[model samples]
Target: MAETTTDSVLVTESVAKYDGAETARKQPPPEKPADVRRRSLVIVSFWLIVLCLGLPIWWQTTTIYRAKLPLDDMLDWAEGRACRPVFPLRISVEANDLQQQEAQNLLRLTQHALDDLNDFSGHHLRLQLSPPGRQNESAEIEDTSALTIRLLPGDSPASALHPYSSILDITYPPNSVPTQTSSSSALATYIAGQLRSTFAEEQAIISYLLSTTSFSNEQRPQGLTPEAAESLAKRTTRSLKYSPTYHLTFSLFTGGHQPSSWDIEAAVDEFMRPVLDVLTPIHNFTIDTQIQLYAAPSVQSQVLNKEDLSSFVNAAEWPLSPSIGGAPTVNFIAYIGNQTIGLPPTDQDASDGALATSQSWLVPQWGTVYLLPLPEDTTHVSVLTLKQPLLTFTSHLLSLLGTPQSGSLPLRLSTLSRIRSADLLLRASSTLGSLARLSLALPSISIPSSVADGVAKTMAHLRLACDTLGTPEALYHARVAEQEAERAFFEKSMVGQLYFPDEHKIAVYLPLLGPVGVPLVMGLLNELKAWRKRRREALEKGKAKKDT
Candidate 1:
């Protein structure tokens, strides 16, 4: 009986301990209506502030700044719809010996023939008859006139471009002159044929440029054959882009200590100055020469083949950096070595005369490399010895500048200006188009106000260039357009912002929002539950009171 009583006492103690624990763990009384409403207001206010003010402020602070761009206008410029390139060449005909009426008739017939022969409408040739006995034809004619034609009566029909002037001198037989009643004349045909041949290279270059672009079929010239186009493509690739100035570097590299110096300054003054002066109207050149002794070439062969010639330049070891300005550099290297170029079996004999051994080779648009063989004891290169090399460099320079091969120096320079203008205009247009396409393809990229400004400036310059296509001012405007387009296309801010991703945004928002949002949402739910219970209890009490 005593043992049972002790067990009952222990059980009572355990039950008492459980009762105390339950009483301590019980929830407090339900919240009052005013308190519930206050908590709800607090939660709602927090969410309202976050949704309306904080989020907007955060978005505005973190968002990229994008200026408005004229995408439609940019696309139009790129598609060749904004501008049409037209090269209007004015040719003046001078017939001092013939009557004024005769010269006018000759000019009219030649103009008709040229028009019929020309398949490319973008490049038009208009001929004008000069007054009789007009002295100093070149000085009197405006800069707009590309070429002047002089008609002289002679025994045989012959046509030749004047070596010093942009004038074509033609000698026609007396019988070749067309009578007043004649519908067509032999003289007119000869003049048209001559003019066509003279501008053939220019036409081919322009047509090739159009073919490479996104030009429509109507704009493209009809006569470019596949082979012709391929050849033109090669030439275009080999030439450098047009620039206002070129840094001309003359480097003399030698394998040994001997022949360490050269009279390059004297040689340039004697032979190259004249050509540079002629090219001044189109381009300016800055010259600096250096002598590098004990310098090794990339290839170590005594007899270099055509394949070896290409790799002879050691670009890594050479100090041929371009000038500081926006001008491009042209390197002319004269390496003193005894290496001979290996000729093919057909050219093995010197007596063949058909294939002469070349001492130098042109490296496309880069420059010329002359393998000048000097005596082992020689310490210096004389100005006389450098004459040949300088002359070769001059010829190569002309080719590098994209000068037409079959004309006088003056005529070629004029042609070069026109070609450069056309090339730059197309290049700028293409750049603008590329930028437009890039912007369209990459929507996340930021476009700054500076980029928009540059695009606007480019378009303005491009329009100016188009209006004055054949003049020097046109070249200047095209150059500016090209620069501005390049600047806008490669804007630094746009590129820098492209790498940021959405993952970073999620990482930033989750940490701050998670903690604050969870408690506010739970508190609001609990408050609503208490308010609903209170309303139900009040309704029950009201019903009981009515029954009583």
Candidate 2:
């Protein structure tokens, strides 16, 4: 009983001790709910402010503005889908004495024959019959027809091409005319042969052009030989790329200051006006003539060999800079000197036979320079004296513009237009393809709205140019298209912003994120520890009460 009582006393003391401890703990220690709420509110408010205001402002300040581009349309324009060029040449027939039915039959048969003979579908010749007895209708016909076929009854069959005019004179017996029922006739066959021969060079050139370009091989003539292809390639490479206008600079370069001036204006008007007038459809030329004295070539050897030809220009000393405008410059230089060209002879005596002749050379797209030996004291050149040089320049200009060497001036100029159009179309397309590849290659490059705007403008202009190709207006639109495409593809800002590296971005972000994140994370960890301690104390008090 005594031990039990002793145990009871001990138990009672322990209980008393526990009660005292419980009462001391139940004093409800600081009731930090307000502090907890205040701390949470501080954090929550800070995060809310950062997310609502700071993040958006940061994004707005750092984000790049991207604009939409019409990439597909641009690619299509470059691929030749936007334009398929066609040349429809008009040919008028003048049959003064033939009856209406006979003339119509001839026309039908000629059309069939010409179509059968024509391999180049791009340049189709259409025949139109002029009313009989029309006076000097040749002048009126010249305005519309590329060429006029004049038929006259004679004793025998013969044909002649009228110089200075595009007239094909064919004399035939009156009985040779086809009847309405006839499918073919001798006159028709003769005309077809004549027409084919006339346009043979043009057909070869056009076929060669189609083959060299991105145009499908199915449309190109398969008959072009390797030699022909090589020649065409040379011609195309030698020619200047197309522009709306061409600046022709006529320079008279002399080693000495004897002939300071020439009647170049008068000479050009006399010798070159006709050709210029003919070429006006393909290119607008601006002529500026100047006399440059004391211009010495790099090689001053008495005899010039093949190597001397290249260094003769003295590009460093010559004032042959391209003109300020967008048009290309063609330089025509008449270098007055006594230096002889030492060309290697094909035969042993060919150089000796040609020693006395003046040396003239064509400088690709630049121009021609004719080395003329003149009297030492002559001060002025007559128009007659300037004739050969001017004529050479005219030929060089034609060659530089890629005109066919074997055709009428009108026909060559027409061909030049077609070639230039194809060149420009391909150039624009290639530029577009490059831009597309660039965009694909660089993901971070910011494409500005201006680039998109330029791309759209380029595509629109390209479409217009393609639609109007082979016309006078096509050049204008093509020029615009080319300029716009260049601008779009080479947009400055696209490349300008590429200098900043990814490392720099990471460096910039690290400072702010590092400092701010540490404090917020530590504060949340301390709050969690305090909450766990309070819950453990409450659970132990409940267990002690249940045991008592």
Candidate 3:
């Protein structure tokens, strides 16, 4: 029984009977040449379509677009190679007491002396004779001049600056007027010296700015002292950045319940209004006032120190919100408190040049704070009591605007314009350089057409500003250039398409192409091998037939 079961398991196939001719295996008939050619053509066509159509479409979809930019010109401007700032200051000369010919002669001689004395190429003083009581070209030049020299017949030669305007009052001897035949005059030399003194600080500051920036040694100011450079550095750090408009917030902060009301409007009108009017040509100011009760300083000691002033502002508690519409705000605070500021031993005379007084101290780039010691029961602050603080504020405002300390108020204001122009020009150039570098470093970042347009406008306005450095128009153009450069550098759409990880790309593309590509490739390879085998068989058969 066991042998029968094993034999049944071993019987896997049934036996078949066939004739002798059927025992020989036979091959299928050979494929026709047309069919062989058709298979090759199909494989080639499919591969050609994939290579020509699919690859190009994929590349076009993934490419990023970049707008053309003036990169070379932008870099040139940034490195101070494209434009050298030059200030052409028109100076009008007038002498009502002298004849017109004498006035002309005096101006010519003074100009010669000035040319000999000036070494800086950036600032040029062009002397023009103002026609007496005539509304013509000379009058127009007078209106545009940076300064006016008014000559008067006097016992001796002396120059005095007009406190209210940009006029240099020069009194000279009667015989000091130059003749057309004379090459020089004592009055001309005296006037030249006065002019040099007037613009000395302005020239130094501009030179300091250039030398510290990207300018070459030749373009730098001829003589800049360490003391002057240090002073300029302090002023630069202390000043607020350039802005077309500044909001002035006059706030009265109190620790007690008293002094709820103040005559801030009347005080500003009486003391600070004139300075604001003078600065109107270069800057615009909007004034507002507020009172905050129970406001305390960050430092609560009865006596405050110099170090305490740095953190005096309770930033979290103060209602000193910034101004809107893209303009900066400057704060002036009068704190009614019993605490007195204790100056260090070395800073006893801080009021002289340190921008601090016994009762007040200036916060760099922010504003000024005055510790006003008032009676505990006082309810209203009078304008009379605010006279000194307001005056202090007026002076501090000029400092905050980066005004030179050595010049008179009018001359300082005029210098303010030139300083601001240079500052804006340099800032715009730096912005352009940064943008260029950013584009170079990031090959994949998209550059929008608006950025290119902004760069174009910036360079154009920068050129205009460089051509008219000393004029008011230069300031306007510089402001525009700076704004445009910033806009170009900060364009919102410059970030390109979202990033796709390599792992994710592989995951997506492998699944898509694996099914379609693998079969095509394997089929073509197998067809090539089979064709070679067929050729070998045909050659072997032909050789055998020849032998027969």
Candidate 4:
């Protein structure tokens, strides 16, 4: 009985120990919900602070502001759909000696003939009969006609152009007049042929210009000879780009101080004024003359060859700086020297004097320098002495302005206006095309609102320019269009941000995003895992109780 009691005591002690341990395990670990809640609140508050404060600052720093642009409208203007240039040249027929009915019939026949002969549809000549009262004073009448065809009775039909006026004098017999019922006449054919010959150079130049540009190639003249085309290309390339105003700078360049002063002002007024007055319709010119002493040609040889002509102008020393305005500068230099131009000594004409000539030569678009051999003591050039040089300079200036080599000054100036308008229109179109291409090529380029504004202005002006093309006002509108197109295409901000590459963007964004993203992501993951563990523990406990 004693042994059994001792065993019961041992068993009771073991049961007490087991029960104490079970009670300790079931106490739920002091209920630390406050700590967990505080920790979660801290983590969420940190994330909220970062999200509210950091992201906005990064976006504000890195964001690019893109401005709206009117690219489509600009492109439309550039495509030649906005405007079509037309030149309706009015030619008055002064037939004071003919009856009104005869004159009308002749005019109608001539119009038909001219229309048949014309290949270029852009330039058309409209024929009109001058009133008897204005026939005699047709030379003074500037507004109605570009040219007047004066019909006089003669033995055989012959034509002579008036030297001082835009008059084509045609001597035709009285029988040459067209009959009322006739659709064609010898007189009409003669008149058409005369008109074509007179305007042949202008037409060729215009045709060549059209061929060289982006205008439809199929419409270009196919009859232009290779030599003629080459010559035209050279002339066009040498000429200054069209502008409403042009600055003419007459400079006297001398190797020594002997010939310093020249009567250029008086000389230009005398020799160049008439030509300038005629050219006024197309280009407004400003004249400024200067004399540069101690200026030497690039070549020191006594004789100049064709190769030396390129380096003849002392570009470094000459003060032929372009005028400070919108217009381009045309320099005319009169260099005082004794150097002669000749073919270089070769196998054929090595010692022949026939190969050599005067040293003066034209420097394409820059100017012409006449090597005048004067007395060492002479300091001033008289107006009479300057007459030849000034005249030569004037001719060179005409060529540089792309004036037609044929035709009178009035006709050349008119043609120049047409050519200039065409050139500016093409240039503006090309600029717009380039801008469109650029925008397409560089996707990251940020276009500014200024570009958009400029494009809109360009398109509007281009439309006006195109509509008024071949008219005097076309030049004004074309200038505006070109300026605006250039401004839009070369907007400063568009290219500013292009140099910043994608690698640079990544480098800029990685630092702030990488550091800040890590803590937020980890905190969310930890919260999710804890919630899943708690739900699983509750489910297992319910299952265990059910099984029991």
lDDT against the true structure, per candidate, is 0.83, 0.76, 0.84, 0.76
Report the CA-based lDDT of candidate 1 relative to the real structure. 0.83
The positional error of residue 201 in candidate 4, measured at the CA in angstroms, is: 2.8
Residues 1-548, candidate 4: write the lDDT tens digits. Answer: 99999999999999999999999988877437788788779888887887898779867875666666555754554554544445677888888888899989898999999999998876788898888978557656545467888888898899998766788899998777778888789989999999999988877776776677555544455677899898787677667766678888888888887676888899999999888988877778988888788887889998777666677777787778686586778877777887877753342222211122253555555556676777778889999988888888788778778887777666667668777777777788778877876776777777777887777787777778777766777777878888888888777777676687889978987896787688788988898787688779889999999999
The residue ranges of model 1 lying beyond 4 angstroms of the native Cα positions read 1-27, 321-323, 344-357, 507-548
Residue 307, candidate 1: C-alpha displacement in angstroms: 2.1
Q: TM-score for each prediction?
A: 0.88, 0.78, 0.83, 0.82
lDDT, residue 405, candidate 2: 77
**All predictions: root-mean-square deviation over Cα?**
4.7, 7.1, 5.8, 6.6
Off by over 4 Å in 4: 1-67, 136-141, 216-225, 317-327, 343-359, 518-548
Q: Write the per-residue lDDT of candidate 3 for residues 197-244, one digit (tens) a residue.
A: 999888888988887876556666767789889978888988999999
Error of 4 at 538 (Å): 6.5
- Clash pairs detected, candidate 1: none
lDDT of 3: 0.84
Candidate 2 residues 119-164, lDDT tens each? 6776677889998776566787766667788999998778887756
Q: After superposition, how far is residue 123 of candidate 1 from its true place, in Å?
A: 0.5
Q: Predictions ranked by lDDT, top down? A: 3, 1, 4, 2
Which run of 10 residues does model 2 get worst, by summed lDDT? Answer: 347-356
